[model samples]
Structures are given as structure tokens and as C-alpha cells.
Target: MNFATRPNFEAISSAPVMQRARGTARIGTKQRDGKTCIDTLFQEGCGKIRLPRTHSSALEAVFINTAGGITGGDHLRWGADIAPEGRLVITTQACERSYRSTGDTAHVEADINVGADAHLDWLPQETILFEASKLDRRLTIRLDEGATLTAIEAVLLGRDAMGEEARDAQFSDTWRIFRGDRLIHAEATRLTGDGSERDGLSLLRGCRAFASILHVAPSADRAEQLLDRVRALHPAAGLIAASANGERLVIRAMARTGLALRKLLVPTLIELTGAGSLPRLWHL
Candidate 1:
């Protein structure tokens, strides 16, 4: 279909998440006969859901999910597709809190596709780990040459509001970034079912909150400029940040508490994106 002749869904103001929610985005190129596609779904099972989409560029869509809390057997699955020259940005309304596991572990999966000359940003808010809760998360990204993607995944051990700490919780996360059919980056972190301690400097450094920011830019020099600022603002405890080879930067910030980390990361995100603030739903 012609760019101007494709069906456009009405701009949804609110995303309802009962037990199941699913979304999709597709785009067609103006030339070269390229195609792009992205789809995401959330299954409540035993939790509340909140997914919202706002604003669109020539070939872009923004998504945010707020899954209040989950017990056991609750799951969320999100996927995306980007055609040649297409772009997308995805976010979450708030932290995903997994309470103490009452049954099985809550699961999350993210699948993405990037067409030639396309771009995508998968920026979800932090995930909070509650005592005794178990979670399994996986992320996979596929991109073609001239395609770009930036993603951020943050995790907070527990809620500080109730004097909760992540010391007693179990969590696991996995991430993979691909350029066309080649894997560019692979990372995994797991803490559970073992007698291993999650404290000390080797891991969280006794901090309850931690965040990771990832950026893939066209220019390595530009990415460095942004990474420099984050390093300057990082705290004294080694800052926990790093930037390596062409066009990729990762920042890790740890704080004594969740709120403290929030104060630091929020401004950093705004600076990196060159925006005053993220979408309103991001702060909710």
C-alpha cells in the first residue's frame, strides 16, 4: 500500500491491561519496496496491565507498558517489526514489581526487527524485584545494515518505601542485540535458587537500585559525548558506567536507595535524548 493509503489506527489515549493485551505496528517503504513490522502483547494471567502508544513520525511508533504487579503464572510478551526506513520507541509506564512468588515465575519476552535504514528504541522502565519472587526475561533484536537501535533496561531489587530490600529476591535477565543476522552484543544477569549472596561491591555494592542505559548511535564520537556527561554526573562509587567501540554506550548507576537512583537517571535520560522530559506516562 502507498504510504498515504495505509490504514491508521486512531491515537489511543489510554491502554487497558486486564489479563491480556497485544499491539502491532507495520510500515511500508516509499521506495525500494521494503517492508517493516512490530507487534507486542501482554498477558495478565494474574496481574494488572497498562500499555499506551502516543505520537508517530514518518515511520515510527512509541509504546509504554505499566504492569502494576504480578504474582505467579503472570506473563507479558512484547514483539516488534520495522520495515526499511522505519523507526520505533517503546517504554513502560512504571516499574514492573514482582511480588514474592506465590506459584511459578513471571515471564517476559521481547522480540524486535529492524529493516535497512530503520531505527528503534526499546526503553522500558526499571523492574522491581520483591522478596521471594522469581522472574525470567529475554530480549532479542535483529537489524539489517544501516539499521539502528537503542535500548535501556533497569532493575530495582525491591521497594524502599516499605523498608523492603532486594536481598531476599530472585531475578534473571538476558539481552541480545543483532545486526542483520550477526550478534553484536549479548548480556545476562541471574540471581536465584542458590545460596549466593546478592550484596557486596561485586554485584550491587550494597545498593538497592541499579539502572542500565544503552545507546546505538550513527557516530561513535557523538555517543562518546553523551557518555562523558553521564560519567561526570555519576556518583563516587566507581560510577558503574562504560562505553566501548563504535556507536555503543552503556551506563550503569547505583544508589543507596531507589529514589536516589531515580533522581540521577531521570535527568540523564533527558540529556541523552536531548528532550526536556520523557513522555508524560513515563513519570507515572
Candidate 2:
């Protein structure tokens, strides 16, 4: 064949398309015969919710991501609702992993509602960001004035044992909480590029692991009492701090490694959540 007439194979070749994951999981609880029971549950795609038998009065739920890890173009959503006088505790089966992204950004959203006199504990495990990973996550909670909520979100830049560091990664996290149409707490965090090298007074200060805890009670006095108890724990002197404003209590902690961060979180969470201990999945 003539060179000019021959087909250009290289020019016709195109990059293979990548598959993206999407999932949604929702659970709702109600008070039945003086016990919290599942009222509604929905799960699709890779998102899953498993109910593990617990001796406590509260209903327990564990979320799972069958996709293993999140990457570019992946989307996940979670939601929960608690009926009056019901109690619920939600946790993850394992730490969430955000792998490197080539294009776009991974997205995750969680919405929760608590009825009057209800209680909810949102305690997901740490989210590890791999090098070059990009993620956007948001959490929204709406509860009645008489309800209570205790939530914790933690993050790790990379695996300490593996000596991995998340360089050139991007992470954006936001939280909005409301009590009966009144906004009580709001937080937004954005980190781009190298997080480990950040040293600004308001930044991570060279820490690779960090966590935020929020507790909302029915009254200011209850929140103050919880804050006092947390203070009694003497959380990692310089690495942790707790404060209370009205009916909301906030705690922030940071450390050099995930293990260190957990050391500070475990006891503090136990006190704030009134759970006596963490979920079984947390130990695993």
C-alpha cells in the first residue's frame, strides 16, 4: 500500500474509558415497643448498610463500600432519620480510602434528621487520602430542638506505617448542622497541594492526621457538662482542645500519625457519645 494511503493506527487510537462508581445508602429508625427499630432502609450500587446485633439500647448501622476505594468521578451518598425517642448509631465497617485521581473529583454527601427527643451518633472512621487524590465531602444534619447529636469526622493524609504521604492532593470538607431551622454549627475545610508541609497557625502545622468532634445537646447546661467531662480527660495537652457555645460543644485534635490521633479520639469520643465504648468495627 502507498505510505500516504495507509491508515494511521496511532492517530485513531484513543485512551480506554474508565469505569466510575456510584452508591447511595439510607436508613431510618423508629421507636417500637420501647426499642429502636429500623423503619426504612435503602441501599443501591456499591453502598451497603448492615445492622449488627448490639446489646445497647440504640440501633447500630455499619456502612460498607463494595468498590473498595474511591477515586476520580466516584459519587457516594448516605442518609439517616430517627423518630421521636429513638436512638441510632452509625459507623463505617472500615476506614475510607481516597485513591489518586486522574480527572474530576470524588464526591460524598451525608444527610441526617433527628426527631424530638431522639438521639444520633455519627461516627465514621478515618478517611485516608492517597497522593494526588481529590475529594469533596459534605455533611448536613437537622434535628429538633429537643434532640441530641454527636458526630466525629477524621482524616489522615497518608498511611503512617507505609510511610506514604499525600502530595499534590486536594480535599474539601463541609459540615452544616441546624436545630429546628436555626443554624447552630458550620465548618468548612479545604486543603490543596502538600498538606504535610503546611505550617501556618490556622493550618495543620505539619500534622498528617486531624479530627473534629461536635456534640449538640438539648440544652446549654448539658453541653457544658459534656465539655467539662471532656476537659477532665486532659486530651493530649497541646494536640487537642474542647470548647462549648450554648448547646453545642466542639473539639478539634491533630497528631503526627493516625495512631496518635486515635489515641486522643477514643477516650474523648467515649465520653462525649456516652457509648461506653466504640463500635466493634472500629477495633477491627
| Tens digits of per-residue lDDT for model 1, 102-158 | 557777777777778777766677788888888888988887887766677878877
The 10-residue segment with the lowest total lDDT in model 1: 20-29
Q: Write the per-residue lDDT of candidate 2 for residues 1-284, one digit (tens) a residue.
A: 65667777776676567899999999989888888999999999999999999998889999999999899999999999999888898999899999999978999999999999988889999999999899999999999868998899999988999998686779999999999899999999888785445566677888889999999978999889988899888544658999999999999999989998998888888886745668988884
Task: Supply the global lDDT for candidate 1.
Answer: 0.65
Question: Between which residue pairs do clashes occur in model 1?
Answer: 19-44, 35-83, 36-82, 36-83, 37-81, 38-80, 38-81, 39-79, 143-180
Model 2's TM-score against the true structure: 0.93
Candidate number with greatest lDDT: 2
| Model 2 weakest lDDT span, ten residues long | 194-203
Off by over 4 Å in 1: 1-67, 193-196, 233-240, 274-277
How many clashes does each candidate structure show, in the order listed? 9, 0
Tell me how far the alpha carbon of residue 226 in candidate 1 is from the true structure, in angstroms, after superposition. Answer: 3.6
